[model samples]
Target: MDNTFDKKHGHELLKKPQFFFGMLLIMSLLGYVVAKGGVVSGIGILAMPIVISYVYLIFAIPNTGIIGIYILNFVAIGIVRYVKGVPLGLTIDAQFLLIYLALFFKTFFHKIPWANAKNDLVLLAAIWYGYALVQLVNPEAASRIAWFYAMRSVSLYMLFTVPLIFILFHKKKDLELLFKIWAILSILATIKGIAQKMFGVDAFEQAWLDAGNASTHLLFGKLRVFSFYSDAGQFGAAQGHAGVVFILLALSQKRSRRLKIFYIIAGVLGLYGLMISGTRGAIAVPVMGFALYTVLQKKTKLVLMGAIMGISVLVFFKYTTIAQGNPTVRRMRTAFDPNNPSLQVRLANQRKLKSYLASRPLGGGIGSAGNWGLRFTPHTFLANTATDSWYVMIWAEQGVIGLWLHLFILFYILTKSVYMIMFKLKDEEIKGMLSPLVCGFFGIMAASYGNGVLGQMPTGLLIYSSMGYLFLGTKLEKENLAIKAKEQLELAQCNK
Candidate 1:
């Protein structure tokens, strides 16, 4: 009777066979593939580990919050251009949306703090986004889909990403982490650009140039060494921005020696990248940023130094023949010459656009200008005219009303940030961190006068994140000091 019972139980267990069919299905498919193509099967077998790792990363990244989002952002800005057939870097759009969803879902599962959500900076961003929404009914708009694509960089990313930064990244270490990532990636970009300059463009990049990009990319028999950015203009301006930020951070007396060294190296590499990009307008970024920094100091010594430097640069460009032999210097010198043919052309185009858009308060629709305009409505008036500056693009799309609002918002944030840095912040390290970010924003804003770099990837992302951090400046300093005080108190108690 016991043997019978045991045999019945064993039979029941066999009936439930867990792995048999699953293993058989997998093995059968593998076997069939191996039989069909042995080497191809082996290749797929080798790729299995990588596929598994990618799957793990996809699931794990959501836990990282803003860090993961920034990592994806870096990839989007620094790597996506090299990837073929991506159609305006769709991966960036998908990843940004995915991260937003992840953060949204995480809020339900975990207790995430809403830090500085009600701040003026964040409120301004909301207004900007709402204004973008209002543009959908723009009567001049040719395609709604075009507006969807064009508006993402203009306002959507800035709208959501800024608040996310505040909520997710609260610690001082978070600021350090962002700067380090920025510096390292910029260094890598410089290296790649150096390779392009010294050797030649890679196969993918060459192919990109071949695909009608050669007209603009290859100027006067010289390549513009864009690295992996969207274009040389973007690359150069971003590099210049990085150079200015890192250089200031390097010069900060409060930073550690190792950190200072790292910043210096990053700054040098960044400047090199800027030089190779052959973008003349990039010079304005650092000059304007540093000049503002000096003024913000409110010291006579710094003021005089900054004035001298500014005057020196002007004189060098205007009067001196020094460094004119250098191709980079030569290109940049043209920026100071009002008589430059390119400058004249740009001015002429702007005048024409002004005349045409004078009567229309809303101007051309968002997608009715620039590359979007050319792609969607090639024969349109705005399509032919060049809205080279970031402000110009805003004017073309949103008209003077929107332009003034944007400017007002920028000036408000900038003034508030300067006040916080100069008066409100007490901690030196915290002040140091915020200073570079604020100054960098100013640099980018000034640079935007030359190119439509402000509303683009990486820069747009950086600007919004900087604003969030600047708004949280006092909070961050207080939290850091409290932590320090607590540690010191604990130490004293232990001694007693």
Candidate 2:
């Protein structure tokens, strides 16, 4: 009777389409909310659809469809943006809501069979939470809103999005589809950046600066190209990362000549976008990402050669008129000058932070530093403090303990990914698939030394999504190998 009941339940689970359809319906409703009102009102209305979907998925689909909903919502928003003329800001807000809904729904699907927690990416999440906990206890940083803000940022950008993309996207075809979407959007963004550079009249940039009462002079004499993203910094960093990824992927493809050519074009356009944004920090992304790739491939000689070549190029650019003639190039040169007012100010701020953090070792709390803290949690230590670097912000807000955990998580992910590349897989296509992600991790890590790319949407999304793919790829590879071995054994037994 128990076996029959189990079988019946399983059969019913397999037949469930309502759960999936309901999820799409909820996403459509959320899309409508975002299209009508902005993010604030949209969040208020998001709950009902989420609740209804959750309940339906729980009783109907055996596998929690939260991740599916998240992806569906992402694709839906893209569709809405293309079809409804919804503003990027509104779309971003809607994406945030979808992320929250996905997280909430994931609770029901948390027990679904997938990759283990020891996976490098999962360890990264653990490290992130550990830092948050430290921030929670620090007296100097006891701001509830700050915690929520941190949670909101991390949850929406990394923790939720990455896992969902990895778990839900099971096929190579799906991965290709996602990459294609990413490429198309990225190319569009690059075109916008190029336009901004050429004619200094981007509606998005002007609107952003006017709304914030901020000036673009801080971006140096070069025109700050924002594209469709929130700021020039984010735009530049994202383009830089995407440029490298596209280029690497293009180089990796053993087939599809036309697609390879398109990728190469996309990569060049992306680099142009990065350059026009006038963010000197953006340069580090490709350097670090490529360096990581070389190191992981056990090409120590290649790494050393690349480093020497990079130094040579830097020296040439510095001494030659080739870079000086270019507006973007001239602006990037400012980043190297210690006497540059911005650099001086950042250094002074770091000194102040060092003194402050020395006594209050536990930190002020998460989201208590940078623009995020000022806007979201004004009561925390860094709410009024100045922290230019992401690492400094983490150190000031969460202290040494928090910083350690964060680093540990990143290192853990790096180690695991490296192991997978080195030992686990021999397939070139699989290696190519993983390369961009590994490079992205390195790029973000290096970029974070100067700016906070880790928390921002594009970079964060890329990181988590790549991490998810890494985890899933490793798991699938192992499963396939196991099944193949089992099949061989069964065939041998039958032959005997």
Candidate 3:
């Protein structure tokens, strides 16, 4: 009987390792399949079964509630592509889907101590909803489409992504990992942009541009490099934002010499990539972001000095047209030219929007105005007209009330973040890290004056995600301070 019991225990112990090995093998195979790049059809075929199994598993193991949903989104995307009879880029899509899924699962399983709705994001959401509500009352106006666009582009995407970011990214290590991924992606984009600039538009980009009916010629016949993003505008803005963040972060880090060198190289390369994108509006983003940082630091003298230099540069560019001599500079100068056809058109559109807005204060319903609106909700008011500026789009769609809410949210967030950086956060490294984020926010706000940047994919993602980080960092800083105070008090009592 003793021999039989010992044998049974040995068998059970052996089975445990086998089960572990099998699970690892399955996970490894899934990763390999994803890396190899053709899981769409397979996912589609297994979608129904996977969904059923996932639902059952979720009920059996509540911790895995989000896994099934993540899988479902990819499967749905695949099924949509299959029905449309379009050849999809499964590799890129799959990678994004996996990242999204991982974030979702992390949020579902782990309770993020820092996650809360007390920051600027909450205000932003409120503004979005307020504007959306306004649109519901007056769906017939042309500006109404802008509201619809906001719903699809800004509101929905943020709702899906920011929560995941807040939950999954709690520690400094997580932030580092995120930055690493961002750096790698930025490098890839820079290389692609350089390639496109050096060699004319490739077959892939050409096909995409043709499909989208966008102009291929950019920067005096030099092809504007878009890489994998939606347009040159987005690519430039993303690169510019990345460049500023990298530079600021590098300056802030207390790292080894080699890592510092790498950061400098990355920053320069990212800036070069931004230049190649030929997006004039993007150039302003970094400057604005940096200015915000300086202001928050209470460097009034520095701010004044920078403003003088900036004005001088603008004057030189405006009067002498020195920028016109250089291809890249010339495009940048175009943004300042009031006579430029695009600017004139945008202004004319704004005038029309203002007249429409004056009549219907509440404005049009949500999902009524821009390209996103037309795609997501076809029956809204402002769906056809191009609402170029983010602020303008908000006003046209959601009216004054919506705009106020949106502004209020941004204002609240900025105030809170600045407060944390100034008072609560004691670490120099942490303060430095937050500088760029603050600056980026300012830059986006400035750029939004000319461009409807609030709804763009990568930019929107960065802004919302950064807000989460800012909130989390503040909470962590406060907690750390409290712990330190407690320790100090205990030590003092013991000494007495």
Candidate 4:
């Protein structure tokens, strides 16, 4: 009698006495849990049935699993603050893997367009992953466990995400939906950050701050609002990334007015989150993103206007202490200051790493730098060193050879995507839609110099998705053109 039953799942099975008994058993268990514990505990027990339903839904519809992975990527690390002891990060891995597992079983009947994922971008990701794999036997590697954990961020996510996007989620509609989801999450994050700013931190957030996070988060007197992200630095960078991407979308004349307004709202709120975050490094995201966007315009007047605006803002921050009263502005200005103590300290550390890594062409190996190094080998020299910059982490961990390879891959994507956007794509609308991906990619790359934001959660996955879609430029344009042609043909026939 359950409306949820389908022929595929055998609705007739409900006629059997065993089925009735099974339903009664489940109901009795739920009731027992509610009686013994409380509503919250009963709800927790219900999760098993819900999880089973979700598992079945994802196996039946692989795209839903992709959505699960995307949503989880944004919230996974933050979930740690609430849910203690569970390896929530692993769930992100599991979600994406489920998508592929479903696809694997499906391959027995359906012929998947595997060739869609064949491209330089995916190849480069594989090559980077292969490099990490090679680091397993790195002579200087202090911990295999470290390599396993660090490599997930370094290469594994990219390897997993890009191919999945190209093969499964390459449609224009899918891309638009992804961007809209991004905006919604960003809006929610900012709302959380604003609450933290206007009122105060919650119990969980306060506990996080008390547990040594206060050192970095609590500046002069202002609390760097981190929202639900791992830290203020990540929150600031991610918000600024959203700001750049959405503002670009808002500027697109080809998009609908409703979407444009939504993009504007998300963009402004994102910038607000960036301001409250007090992460000086994140300021680079907007500065560099807008600069790149202006140049991409290739119009003299627009470039000149952008330059003028850029200079005015730079001079205001660098020369005049106009907003010195404001903590956010004050902290951001330090990024431009050459003699700032923290910058000097970071430079000093880089110099030390340079001298240490110069002798070893292969360097300290994967997980030998950053938090992983600090954890697995606290007494080691590199472990004591802080890799403030993402590139520096790669250099310290992977050495000059690996650094060169990494740079090559990134630059190749940036330059090639630019060429495709600038020349290869015909439709102005699609170009506008895709332009933000390149701009945001550049912004994150530039910001990565100050903080290791690029390879971190959400940003890394998003970038890999961008790379996938950007490479699908020609195909997307064809689809766009087809739609336009159909519309025009309809109009002509209507005129007749």
Question: Scored by CA lDDT, what does every candidate get?
Answer: 0.81, 0.68, 0.65, 0.89
Q: Kindly list the per-residue Cα lDDT of model 1 for residues 1-496, writing each as its tens digit.
A: 3676556454455466675676678889888887886755666677789746654564456535456556666556444345433343555566566656766666777776764576777788999989888889878777788788899889888887777677666567878898998888888888889999999998778887898888877888888888878789988988988998899889883538998999999988888888899998888888888897887677899999999999999999888889988877888889999999988988998898789879867868888788899999889888888898899889998888779889999999999999989888878877777888888899899889889999786677888888888888888999889988999999999999
For model 4, residues 1-496, the per-residue Cα lDDT tens digits are 8565444356777888899899999899879887987755665676778878888888898889888887888888777887666677887788878888988888898987788888888899999999999888889999999998899989999999999888889899999989999999999999999999999898888888898889998888789999888889999999999999999999984548999999999999999999999988898899888988888777889899889989998899899999798888999898889999999999999999999998987779899887899889888888999989999999999999999999999999999999988778878889888899899999999999999999898788898899899998899999989999999999999999
| TM-score-sorted candidate list, best first | 4, 1, 2, 3
Cα-based TM-score, every candidate: 0.88, 0.74, 0.72, 0.92
Candidate 4 residue 246 C-alpha distance from true site, Å: 0.6
lDDT of 4 at 356: 95
Q: In lDDT terms, which candidate is top?
A: 4
The order by descending lDDT is 4, 1, 2, 3
lDDT per residue, candidate 3, 229-314, as tens digits? 66677777778787878887887878567666666767778788778777877878776766666666677797897678677767
Cα displacement (Å) at residue 141, model 2: 2.8
Q: Candidate 1 vs. truth: CA RMSD?
A: 4.8
- The positional error of residue 413 in candidate 1, measured at the CA in angstroms, is 1.0
Per-residue error for 329 in candidate 1, Å, reads 0.6
- Predicted candidate 3, C-alpha RMSD: 8.2
Q: After superposition, how far is residue 75 of candidate 2 from its true place, in Å?
A: 11
**Candidate 4 structure lDDT:** 0.89
